[model samples]
Target: MAAEPAMQMPSLEELQHWTWVFGQAQQMMLEQGLDMMAHMPGPAAMSHLFEPAAAFRATADFWSDTMTLWSRFLTQEPGAPLGEDAEQARDRRFRAPQWHEQPLFDFLRQSYLVIAEHMLKGVDALEGVDARHKEQLRFATRGFLDAMSPANFPATNPEVLEKIVETKGESLLKGLQHMLNDMARGQLTQTDPDAFEVGRNLATTPGKVVRRTPLYELIQYTPTTPDVLKMPVVIFPPWINRYYILDLTPEKSFIRWAVAQGATVFVVSWKSADASMKDVTWDDYVEGGQIDAIDTVRDLLGVESVHAVGYCVAGTTLAATLAVLAARGQADKVKSATFLTAQVDFSHAGDLSNFVDDEQLALIRSLSSDGYLDGRYMAATFNLLRGRDLIWSYVTNNYLLGKDYAPFELLYWNSDVTNLPAKWHLAYLTDLYRDNRMVEPGALSIGDTPIDLSSVKTPSYIQAGREDHIAPPESVWKLTEHFHGPMRFLLAGSGHIAGVVNPPSSGKYQYWTNGRRVKSLQTFLKGARETKGSWWPDWIAWLRGQDGQTVPAKGERIPGKGKLKSLCDAPGTYVRMR
Candidate 1:
């Protein structure tokens, strides 16, 4: 028998063109079918056409206003600006040269805006479909309109056209090369990689690896104060990214700031997973990872209790660990719990939850045959949630205008991704995102014990980002109901990472707190008082009150002094791995 012929693969450009062609065809079919149904001569047809009729009316009104603005501009009469509300335009890249100023470009931009609005309204007006389907439809519709925006094309984009004219087409050639390089790498080039070195410039806060585990390394930051608080702090950051996000540069380092405030700080730096660690489960993380870190901190400080902090997914894990400890009659292990933008209830998890249905979950499992979900895949999903900012803006800058990516610390941290273990990822999706079992009593288990958040009863401090897309403030507020102990909830004015990493020295954003618990999130917000500063100072003050009493500082305590011996320097061996 003859050998089988080799299969051919489509280029990225070819794939994109084909996708657009298919979308156009589907849109045409839908429009034609709707038109046919509208013309049918029967009462049932008219009844069935109510939503489409409303959508048509709305579209007509939108276009009528658009035409009136154009007519005024052509006749040289004073008229309202086409794109007057800059805040409504979510994509910043459209603010490039002459897009809002030039008549022709402004008209194009406004036309796209009107169409997008109509599309969203049409999705909302659909009567028969369930909420989940409607959400999916809205998401897909927005993605299509975003792709069709004139600003994405070099020929139609004013800024890209000007760049070509200025550089005599050399910029376009460079941009093409950049686009090709990014396509080959399977990710957008978000920052200039040559500008940063991890240890020297990025994760530079001084510290040492006090202990190492199969899953993580415990880093004890060098104390910066003369006398430290008796209670130490152990932070568990989400393992999806490196722990350096909390230690990114001295000015913004949370660990450094906490140490300076007279607190001994330790952070768990998780290992990037590979096939060898595929069998690790949620139980292993709670018991062997977080609980073990608590034990190490107690031994190192010669104290019984320590303050426990967790960010994002790690926050959920920390809550589960606390419940497990409480079940074992070790409730005093954690003196207090702090959660940053963490969600105990996943019912209202924002746009991220739209991609977590049964079909998508199965697809993810099939793709994780290597025993881990690839970091690139996770990054792509997040970028899609804010495609205009995280995806296409980079596209226009790197591929159309031929501009080098600026060196940004936050973007760099975002690009420094880590693989998640396949087993743990699946369990997290099924238990938390899909079933939302974390908030329910005895629905989730760790080791041999079923975890229950209501039984934990540790005093808690929770912070939620006002603009967080991953874990919305409404979802975070649900934690108040689950925790039986005293709770202080804060609403910070930024997105997920920025809200948590905010330093008081910056004097940038504001936070809100009512100092009184309420049953509803909206009610809490309505009664909350706006304070002009970062929430970090408030947190530090609260922590100080909980610290019991002051003690003599262990100046630059070496890692090898504790029962858990030193494995390496700060940032450890696992963080150094790819």
Candidate 2:
């Protein structure tokens, strides 16, 4: 390892501010919230949407600024402050002495930012295009700017050069080794892959696989306490990824926390879809997936109903299943519903919406020749969304800095790839993103039943991450408008995953709450009260209030009366399939 850079680093306050900047962008960039739309729009990815005149103006201004910064580079000192954006101080990428103390590198940094800012402004100034097209352009432009940062290139990056010199070329050698290792694995090394394992440290929650269906396997977690909530809790995790995200390490696991709180928890572990499952439709997910999950929980527990929870796309399906059931006059099957960053209404579906038009649809079909759209494509799109962090940061760290990434259970779960069934994924994009049909009265038909969200009478708790890029909080907010129920909408302090999976024990981010239904999301945020710590407690308290009854835990783990038996352990075969 090379010695630390001689230049002083930014203060803690400045670092925190940069984190804020990144947050707004993750909150800006990319699962996405649902599989409906996360990839870049074909048109946006191919070219810029800026007007020719605006482009010229932006380039001329950027050129002037670049020349000005270059000429004055020698006059600046490492300690000299970049004006008070407060955000730039926090970038974290250019921390070495050369980046600040040296003139050329600092000029490179400022020049990139100058042109990037102007380019975005030009996109904003674009005319003759709809707002959706404009947003797509802005997002694509941001990705390009993030990729073009001087810090990403070894030749241009001062920190990497310093590392090579300090380590006498050992850093470059080690970087080649790391890059080659990641190449062989077919994924970026964001964390030490050896640090975490599924059943060993990650999803170690004690439980049994109570039921197995073609689409998923239902795992009921063992309760830590002797007594448990009368209503068993069933979770529907997004099929786009593994269920273990909610069941991470015991310390951070939302499932473990709920079980410890005297609630029985069951999660749907989706199978990594393959060509055999390519024909599977969204209706299967609604009926065969979530419906099957809840039915197993109710039947195996010998109960009539249970509290239902869903994350990401699963939440979308859960809501649809509820609507379908409610229309069929079986609304009581799910006593209450909790949605974690799920968007049922897609009208304002952020940057991802541009990825759902006819052109993109044709492209997806071509890729789905094997019955599934490779999940890696979606993961890649998400990486592009947060390229500065997920993509470039790792490239700089693993392949340039000659340093191994720290073990992050979240990133591990993220890298544990899962594929999507072509039928279900396509239906999601077409019906939801392209057509905006989920919220329509009878437009969506799951299991031959017309889906009507208004008919869903179950009490609901809707949670959205404030800076969620994958499922923009604003898109999640639209669900509050469509779902007819006694609803509680909350805005958590971080982006999608961090916001939702945040454990109360960390005492990290805060959550905002507005019990009253407001007309606009902005209004909700305005009148909302902010509370420090995780929103897990608030959700649990709300869950308990739905029904204060209890049940004996002694034999509840013994799912099914006599015929049904445990197929496997929790975090079952399906999750480990691929």
TM-score of each: 0.89, 0.89
| Model 2: lDDT of residue 32 | 23
lDDT of 2 by residue, 1-578 (tens): 99886766556575456445433433232212111122334444323444567657765665565445644653443434322146766787767767775655666666556656666666677666677766776776777777867798898898888789889999989989999998897778788889999999999998888788888888877777888898989988888889999989988999999999999888888999998897899878887887777776777778889999989888888889999899889899999999999988888776677577787789889999999988888887678778888999989988988996799999999898899998888888998888888888998787568988888879999999988987899999888788778899999999889998889899999999987779888999889999999999999999999997987886755443224677877778999987
Report the C-alpha lDDT of model 1 over 364-439, residue by residue, as the tens digit: 8998998988888888898899887888878888998999879988888888888999899988988899899998
Error of 1 at 364 (Å): 1.0
In candidate 1, position 416 carries an lDDT of 84
Clashes of each: 0, 4
- CA RMSD (A), model 2: 7.4
Tell me which residue pairs clash in candidate 2: 25-28, 27-467, 30-470, 33-470
Model 2 lDDT vs. the true structure? 0.80
Query: Model 2 segments beyond 4 Å from truth?
Result: 1-60, 74-84, 559-563
